[model samples]
Target: MSIKQRDANKNLEQTKSHLQSNHAIHHQAKKNLVQQPVTRFALFLLGTAATILGIYAIARHFSWWQLPYTSIAVIPTEAAQASLPPNINTNFVTAVVDRVGPAVVRIDAAKTVTNRLPDAFNDPFFRDFFGSQVPQPGRRTIRGAGSGFIISPNGRILTNAHVVDGADTVKVRLKDGRSFEGKVLGADPVTDVAVVQIQAQQLPTVKFGNSQQLQPGQWAIAIGNPLGLDNTVTTGIVSATGRSSSDVGIPDKRVNFIQTDAAINPGNSGGPLLNQQGEVIGMNTAIIGGAQGLGFAIPIHTAQRIADQLVARGRVEHAFLGIQMLTLTPEVKQQIASDPNSWLNVDEDRGVLVVRVVPDSPAAKAGLRVGDVIHKLNGQSVTEADAIRQAVENSAIGKDIRLELRRQGRTLNLAVRPGAFPTAQVE
Candidate 1:
């Protein structure tokens, strides 16, 4: 009976153990499936977050999110950096100051005449607008200040036409602090370049650079005698180009000006507009309407040419074609006939149209007539009025050049000598 009971108990225990093992295996398999999915999902989220942070870091490093290209400068040139040498290639503006600072001068002009202002402003009618202004028409001493530059070593200064415009007595100052009486050599109101020669010789003369090559945002320096302050140097950059003064009474004019945001005051006129290379690229002449940092200068190419002529001959002998020209108009085409003369003497439209012919000018001498269309100067085609001016300016005085012209529907060749530019004071 003991043996039978032992066998049965052992079989029961074996069956229970087998069932427990199967259940344990099933539970382990279920736990593994759930844990594997959760682990994979957590790893994927961590990888995505790391990738986003990396991309953000790269974008911040590259500055791709900034303005593409609008021209705006950050800082103005330092004021106290006049001693450094200004080289065109150098980034430092101080180098430019050193180049032209020696040549820039101070002009102390005095018109010793009785004040010509009238006292009628003291009347109540004038007081309202002019604020109790008194016009002293009587004689009173009138003293004023201006700026100038020494173009030659022998103290020949270049100043504004207005500075010594009506000055009775003029005094020039050097950087070293010597003052000398100056006599006006010649002043051209059209170009605003004047030549004044002093007794001094071997003076520090500023070098000239080509303004035609000046680029906007390049460093610019204005060295002048501002407010009687000699050798005053200020800094800025080229703001604009090819500006016209048609609004300021000087209409029918073409000026390739260097615009700068430099701080230019009234007395800064006639100062040298220098490039970062410290070369005189232009002459500071006018500013826009009491505006701050809006200054304009005459291209040095124009100034130097005019100054050279004024100093040499006391006048600019602009060659005269003695003809009136108009931009190519539709009316001009109507005038041209289909059958132009044998010498290509047919009316060709486009470009400047000749309106009138002057009586004894070089053009008249060269047998040019009204209705003659000039297509090219030398060999290049003429497109604008500025092109003609620039071409004629580049020519030396009395240089014979060939012109290709269209007249009455005929193209012809005309040879003429360029004369000195004439001062055509706008009527």
Candidate 2:
């Protein structure tokens, strides 16, 4: 063989060996690249499982293992329902009515009312022409209905004076379907409180609450026979307290009334206004005409006070100073000063101004004349006329009351003895 052929043969063999080595290395690299992704996926799955197990252990430690898997529902028991708010249910009212219903009564009063003939019928020419044919006066019956509450076990009931006023017959009906003839023991028109006696035993009586502690926004429930409907119940909140009689348009009454939004019709006058505990707090009395949610009630304290007097003495004598007055304000003073025929001079403001002093009354006897501005009563400052009236009402009859007045820029102190309110005036 030639030397060139031998060299070529050797170079070919070396190239073939080099190619085989490169192919082996490329196959191993391809196999490793395919296995790398599988190993990474298995490691990721193991890490996720560990995280889930750790979370389960923490939940079991906190006793919240069932929180994510279980649903919870709340169920109220009887005690839970009872512990709920009062406004959520009418159970309070129902309880009150059930407790107090038996003591409430229906009062039906009847009176004989005579109708008189006109004056023209009595003329001489007409009488002569008619000659016993003239229309004669007719007699009729006036019937009224109201409500009352039993105060004593022996059938002593408290009601409004107007309920039995001029009544010839009074019939009382109870909840147990029993009726009785009621006799008026006494009636005080000033306080509008009356006591009726019925011969009975073992009667259900009412419990009275303190009206002086009453506040606005308290519950008020009224049970009455309004418009001839028996056992009518109404509910509302107390709108205000200590409302003057004048503020309620009942100047003749001498009561500090409890104002409520409860429904009060004609026949609800004497019914009991109860509190949440079923205690009598007031007496349903009056309501403003054509106004919604405006009703007034006499305080239970005042009603009981007057009722006691009526039962004990067959009458109530209210203390009277007999003076017509008004609260003095800057506008009133200015009006009086500007008027030519006011016939009075008011120099001070923010006091009760005596517009007129009744002749021969306790005020007049004590030299309390018109134009005097009453500044104080019994060492207490007085700004409203109702305050003076209340002071006089609180005073005993024939007892001296101290008065401080500003008359023509001079302050004077006087003592006046109150007199009994006249029955004729009340009638």
Considering every candidate listed, which one attains the maximal TM-score?
2
The residue pairs that clash in candidate 2, if any, are none
Off by over 4 Å in 1: 1-103, 110-144, 152-154, 174-178, 200-205, 225-233, 240-255, 263-265, 288-294, 309-315, 329-349, 365-372, 396-401, 407-413, 416-427
Q: Give lDDT per model, in order.
A: 0.72, 0.89
> Model 1 — TM-score against the truth?
0.59
Q: Best by lDDT, which number?
A: 2
lDDT of 1 by residue, 156-183 (tens): 8888887887778888877787889999
**lDDT for model 2:** 0.89
Per-residue lDDT tens digits for candidate 2, residues 118-212, read: 99998999999999999999999999999999999999999999999999999999989899999999998898898999999999999999999
RMSD of 1: 11.6
lDDT of 2 at 379: 98
